[model samples]
Target chain A: MSTRLDFFIDRMVSQRACLDFGIAQTADMQGPVFELGLGNGRTYHHMQHNIKGRDLYVFERAVASHPDSTPPEELTILGDVRETLPAALTRFGATASLIHADLGGHNRAKNDAFAQLISPLVEPLLAVGGLMVSSDRMYFEALTEMPLPPEAVEGRCFIYRRDS
Target chain B: MSTRLDFFIDRMVSQRACLDFGIAQTADMQGPVFELGLGNGRTYHHMQHNIKGRDLYVFERAVASHPDSTPPEELTILGDVRETLPAALTRFGATASLIHADLGGHNRAKNDAFAQLISPLVEPLLAVGGLMVSSDRMYFEALTEMPLPPEAVEGRCFIYRRDS
Candidate 1:
């Protein structure tokens, strides 16, 4: 019996909780961080402040965020993710310690389609024990779903880890 | 603007998320798990299923949980937490890896007072790096507040880690 507002709150809170856990869990790992679909750059801004000793790269078609939240040009990859993500494998290899995506909108059909399309592209990017936080359930061939932290709503946010 | 139901859902989801994280984080740590208030034994049941490699002890004055949720006599300490928690220090020593407490009710003043009383008692039982998850804000001199997961609502659930 949750309203749309309740769902939104759940999504936001769950996203934060998973991100915090991912950052902490991967603190000792060596790799850059990737943020997919940095709409308004809020999540990217959060990563910018909290993540240490790791470069954060944002994948987006373009930049349109709060003045303070936008990433520097050098760190921002401006292109469709379908193109940029695969290209990243060559430049960065499968060495991302964390990859966060919130690419889907209100359309359920479109969201599912997008998740299926990107899941494979995202899976190969994570390093061993690396965490993936997503707004939609993603299809991964090898990545395992990690248990959600206690503030995360089930189905609202998803976390997957690369074991190999 | 959230309804009472929304708050309830947040509490439930946050509780589950925190417990899962605490259980996983402490999987390699030494010492047992403690359930400070086994109200209805829902959380206890959860810990029983998910927790491994450690014994789980419940502190409660009496047992009134559903039959399926009840703990065995040996693991269930049947006394008020104010008395039994201190006694636990002598029996179990300061080596609990995870302690989950939901000792407060709806009354703000009463909940605050209870949290204050139990915070000190609870603080000494944890092993270093052990996590404490609570339903109310606890005043801890040494334990640091860990960031919440994305699904958890702020102030609805709190997680603290004993770093020493």
Candidate 2:
């Protein structure tokens, strides 16, 4: 495993790589951006600028980001991801072209379990050829690993392209 | 300097980081994405997908990329960048929001000189709060070094945020 700083950087770098690769795969794709976790909203804000032209819907238990990073009320889907995610399918439907799943923290065991629970609900919303950039390794039947952008450690920042 | 694979990865990772940070800095600014060197067109293609809703004007010496990576004719500004770039000001007129400069090669000294020569003309087109992601150590009077994203070898992937 990498150091704490490396972990932090890996998440960012891998996510960026996924977005870049996702763009390559789906240049014509026009769909909303989905956020599995809106942690500090720093990544969310970063995603907004880097990956422009997509409506962003965020899932969070509570609004904990710095006031500046706070997303608008409409874009925020509150409540625990385990609960809010199901509701996302009904609202957004299968329309997400890019998903940044930054869930799971230091607790490897708990996060693995949580990732299992959340992934199914989230997977349905991603369009075919959509990109899922996640911190924890989650396997969806329809998703396959895409090449990682340089500096991304294998297994650390997992990137999958939804194919089915 | 990193190995060839590392260098390739560094270029993409740093570019992604810069675009991500640049987006955070300027959410409302609307301008075209600029490219100082359109090597292979992979990064430009990635930018197209990762950063949507922006016009991309690429400066390239010749049609060099794989056919699939090619940009449309309207977006391609072909010629010596230094000569063509000045012409760009007449057409684009200081309206670039993000600049991806992937110039320089085995000849570090020559590339440094080229970067310096090009920086002045290119820098003016970038908006006050735009972003410039480059490969060398070229510094613009109005631009400042944005923090290097994690794992970005210092001096390899230079990210500059333009602050008027």
What is candidate 2's lDDT per residue for A1-164, written digit by digit as tens? 22232344465556656655655565567898877777766567666655656787888887887565678998888888777878878977887888878887767899899888877877888887788888888857677877777756677777877777
Residue B114 displacement in candidate 2 (angstroms)? 41
Pairs clashing within candidate 2 = A150-B9
Per-residue error at B26 for model 2, in Å?
Answer: 41
Candidate 1 CA-lDDT value: 0.87
**Where is model 1 more than 4 Å wrong at Cα?**
B1-164
Tens digits of lDDT, candidate 2, B1-164: 22232344565556556655655555566888887777766666666665667787888888787564678999888899878888988887777888878877657789889888888877777777787888787758878877886745666677777666
Candidate whose lDDT is highest: 1
Error of model 2, residue A145, in angstroms? 2.4
TM-score of 1: 0.51
Q: Tell me the DockQ of each model, to 2 decimals.
A: 0.02, 0.02
TM-score of chain A of each: 0.98, 0.88
